[model samples]
Target: MPKLTKRTIDATEPQVVEFFIWDESIPGFGVRVMPSGRKSFVVQYRAGRRPRRMSLGPSTVLTCDQARTRC
Candidate 1:
């Protein structure tokens, strides 16, 4: 995984954005911003031959450390 770049994404009070990391030539990991401005970490791994979407949960509800543990 690559380093995440911190930057402002939206003008709203709850800003939403995304940070990506390349793993083994694939964008296999990233963090997504929710409408509430919460940051949730995500990992895109293949389930057999198909891709899957997994939620790490809301930022306030789950800390980055917690989300990482989920991943």
Candidate 2:
């Protein structure tokens, strides 16, 4: 799987849906977009045998830049 780059995030509904449907190989990132058009970032990765996941918090509360820093 390729490393997730900042350029990959969609920032819009149509692109977000396409990303999930088309990009299934990448293994380090997930997203939660809100009805108000806010997006929350998540980190998904494997640590040894277990799958590790972390929530970077809500987008409105934490900017996209801030979310990346948390990861």
Candidate 3:
């Protein structure tokens, strides 16, 4: 997968099913693209033995760099 840069995000068109594009550089830092074409920043991490997902905000509200450093 490509790095989550502004260009990458813009180039990634939403698909029929929602999917996540994780940043290889920052483990869980990534974005979620809904089937509706909505995009949001997301951070995934383990809560105890189980994993969890958190939505930071819409992609319009946070930049890739901001999302990367947030989690």
| Best TM-score among the predictions, by candidate number | 3
Q: Candidate 2: misplaced stretches above 4 Å?
A: 1-11, 14-27, 34-38
Model 3, 1-71: lDDT tens digits are 76788888878898999999988878888889999889999999999999999998889888987877778
Query: What TM value does model 3 have?
Result: 0.92
Tens-place lDDT digits, model 1, residues 1-71: 44432332122244444443332333555566555555655777889999987776754476545656677
Show pairs that collide, candidate 3: none
The 10-residue segment of model 2 with minimum total lDDT is 15-24
Model 2, residue 64: distance off in Å is: 1.4
Cα lDDT of all candidates, in order? 0.53, 0.54, 0.88
- Residue 18, candidate 1: Cα error in Å is 7.3
lDDT of 2 at 35: 52
Query: What TM-score goes with each of the models?
Result: 0.52, 0.50, 0.92
Give the distance in Å from residue 30's predicted Cα in candidate 3 to where it truly belongs: 0.9
Model 3, residue 19: distance off in Å is 0.4
Report the lDDT of model 2 for residue 48.
94
Q: Which lDDT tens digits does candidate 2 get at residues 1-71?
A: 23333454443464334232112444465565555455667787789999976767754576545665676
Give every collision pair in model 2: none
Arrange candidates by TM-score, descending: 3, 1, 2
> How many clashing residue pairs, candidate 1?
0
